[model samples]
Target: MPTARAIDTSDRHPIRAFLDLRWGGPTIMLDGRAIDAAALPGFVALDADGAIAGLITLLDDALQSEIVTLDAVQAQAGLGTHLLELAAERARALGLGRLLTRTTNDNLDALRFYQLRGFRLHRLAAGAIDLEREADPAIPLLGRHGIPLHDEISLIRVLGAD
Candidate 1:
């Protein structure tokens, strides 16, 4: 129902909102934290009507990229996959070896989504979720699907088609 398009410069606010929504809420990024305005080169996928639907952010260093947040109002649509392909293209163009991302143990859908797209298990931040709670007690202990959020699972996909 929606087609993907590049994110516009004026769309920065919505992109930030997507990050905040995914991260639980607007709060300071702990440690080496970077968001839209701070993230030097980012991409977003717009729906047919030109609304922000999904986004991917890549740190300038180019070694890694964060999905940041990707949401498709219509589940049956292929918007997510399109955004992912765009991200991969950008990563390849940047000559990055691979792209890395993290999702909570409770995000079963994300686990499947990334895995299905060729991302593989790399590492699990054993206490990152707890550290997050320490930073923001308001961060939900439970995930969108009601599963208890415990740890962050790191996943990676080599940028080269090899």
Candidate 2:
């Protein structure tokens, strides 16, 4: 299993390189807003070889922490879950009440993954992806399973006192 650690300034190069390779650059569109993943604070999971196996970036606010990006180089390896767990821990440490994330309508895997891990559907912003595409034309029309990526689904997991 890979070990997860908090992302620091020294990780900028690898993080940006990883995001650029996987997501076509660190700027990700969420809720029609452009967010620079490289600038956010989050966690990274490294394999035995000390190579980045997965990473997650978050935006912490007054009320909740939003998972801006979460990706594992290899699926079914528990890397995603580990990163998510760390994000929740960080949120709680910051005195935040909730952990929130958004996924596209076509990302059925994400919907299942988040829901299975205690997240509940909070909102459905119809046509939100369409608006986002206006800003980032690279937003694909079709996503996993060949489904049209059109809307945004928000998920939230409320933290209990720890």
Candidate 3:
């Protein structure tokens, strides 16, 4: 298997191209506002063949840190976990003290995954996707398991402690 390494986005263009392909853009929506994932720092995992296997984008606002996106090309390989851990580690390094993320209510897999990684359910932002879609129509109306992509489930992980 090919090893995964952090992507060097310092060069900018290549990373942007890759991100644009995976996500609609470097910009993402959170709590009714538009935020650019490429504008901030993130971690991308390169597979053994030097292909993009997984990535996690982040945003640090005045209140807390948010994981904009997390994707793995291959599943059940600990790729998601590794990327998440790296994002959390970076948050702690920045003295943020906590890492937060949001997933659609339809995404049961994401809910389970984040909880398994020590993130607690924070809140549910009902109809949040409506606002998000206004800015970006690409936000699918329905997601996996036939669930309607509507509400936003907030999850948080505390840092700087055992």
| The best candidate in terms of TM-score | 2
All candidates: TM-score: 0.81, 0.95, 0.85
lDDT by residue (1-162, candidate 2, tens digit) is: 788999999999999999999989999876556789998999998989888999999998899999999999999889899899999999999999999999989889999999999999999999998888887788889988999989999999999863
lDDT of each: 0.68, 0.92, 0.78
User: What RMSD, rounded to one decimal, does every model reach?
Assistant: 2.8, 1.2, 2.3
Report the Cα lDDT for residue 121, model 1: 99
Give the C-alpha miss distance for residue 60 in model 1, angstroms. 3.9
- Residue-wise C-alpha lDDT for candidate 1, range 78-129, written one tens digit per residue: 7677777877887787777787777889988889998999999999887678
Off by over 4 Å in 1: 17-40
How close to the true structure is residue 80 of candidate 3, measured as C-alpha lDDT?
A: 90
lDDT of 3 by residue, 1-162 (tens): 234444465625655766789876766766666676666667777766656677777788665678888888777789899888887777777778788998889888889999999999999989888778777787789888998888889999987653
Q: Estimate the TM-score for candidate 1.
A: 0.81
Alpha-carbon runs more than 4 Å astray in model 3: 1-7
lDDT of 2 at 52: 92
- Please report the TM-score between candidate 2 and the true structure: 0.95
